[model samples]
Target: MREISLAEMPGLLGQEVGVSDWITVDQTMIDLFADATQDHQFIHVDPVRAAESPFGGTIAHGFLTLSLLSAMNFESIPKIREQTVGINYGFDRIRFVSPVRSGSRVRGRFTLADCRFRGAGMLMTTYDVAVEIENERKPALTASWITIVQFDPKDRPEGV
Candidate 1:
């Protein structure tokens, strides 16, 4: 991942931050996610059944796609220097626009939508993220994801 000084964060507002490397969503990965999440939905875990459905074959669960953001971020997004920890704050909005078929390659494109001081030593960052399905016209999902990053108090600027 790219590392940038915390001081440079404010300058990144509304900028396209990064694009992650492609990851293939195969049946094995889909089945494991279903099992872990206890979803066991046919469209996600049953290829034969899913093949006859509207998607034409097994598709990854929407949440599974959503859950990949952190991995994708680690692969390409810029990190703040001296940030000790980052926590998933939540999503302001999320939309599943297209199905990610099994064996499909997907990648995340992130934009630094907003940033704000949360407390004395924390910064809340929001990203506009799009999960693009390889060779597909429509993206699989789009979300406004937030993360709270903790930096050393000594690195924090004085005042707001």
Candidate 2:
């Protein structure tokens, strides 16, 4: 991940930050996600049954795709030089625009949308994120993702 000073945060707003490496969403991953979430609908876990559905085959759960943003962010977003940790604040808007079929690959494209000081030691950032499916025109999902970065005031850069 790239490292940046607090003073540089403002300049990144509305700029594309980074794109994550592609990740395969195969049957095993789909099955594991289903087991973890208890969402065993045929379209997500049963290939034979799902093959007859409108999707034509098993597809990943929307929540499963949404949850992937954490890993994607870690791999793509820049790190604040003074930040000690970052935590998910929640999403503002989320849309599952396309289904992720089994064995498909997906990656995240992130743009810094907004940033503000939430408190003395906390910074709130909003990112416009899209999960693109490999070789597909439409993205699997899009969202306004928010996160909070916690840092010590003493470590903050001058004029930040």
Candidate 3:
């Protein structure tokens, strides 16, 4: 993970970060997510019944793919230099492009899309993350994530 100062990130407005290693979305993973989130939809839990559904098998919940973000960011996480705090500023456009069926592999490709100055010394940045399926043309998920990094807590920007 390359560390770049908020100021230096301006030139990286459209650079794609390296892709994360593949992660399997198996029945157990979906089941665990279902249990954790208390979303016991039959299409996500019962494989036999799911096999008869339009999805053709148990499918991972859309939120499950979204939930993988923390892991993706943490594992080999990139650090923004010259910033004291990096806050998750939320996403803009989010789309579940395709289903992540049980036993499928997925990974993320992050692209630094935009950067802007905010209050004091804070910098706002946007990342376009594509959750790609193994050997597939269609992505499993597409999300635009916003982040705010400040040189000091006092430099934090006001809410939008």
How far in Å is the alpha carbon of 144 misplaced in model 3?
A: 1.3
Which ranges of candidate 3 are over 4 A from the true structure?
153-160
lDDT for each residue of candidate 2 in 57-142, tens digit (9 for 90 to 100) = 99999999999999999998888898999999999999999999999999999999999976678889999999999999999999
Residue 160 of model 1, lDDT score: 56
| Candidate 1: clashing pairs of residues | none
Note the residue pairs that clash in candidate 3. Answer: none
TM-score of 2: 0.96
What TM-score does structure 1 among the candidates reach? 0.96
lDDT (tens digit, per residue) of candidate 3 on 1-160: 6675554577777888556778999999999999999999999999999999999999999999988876776553367767787789899999999999999999988888888887677788888999998988999999999988778645343442
| TM-score on alpha carbons, each prediction | 0.96, 0.96, 0.87
Candidate 2 weakest lDDT stretch, 10 residues: 151-160
List candidate 1 segments past 4 Å from native.
158-160
| Number of backbone clashes in candidate 1 | 0
For model 2, what is the error of residue 81's alpha carbon versus the real structure, in angstroms, after optimal superposition? 1.4
What is the clash tally of candidate 2?
0
Ranking by TM-score: 2, 1, 3
55-75 per-residue lDDT for model 1 (tens digits): 999999999999888899998
What lDDT score is found at residue 151 in candidate 2? Answer: 91
For every model shown, the clashing-pair count is 0, 0, 0
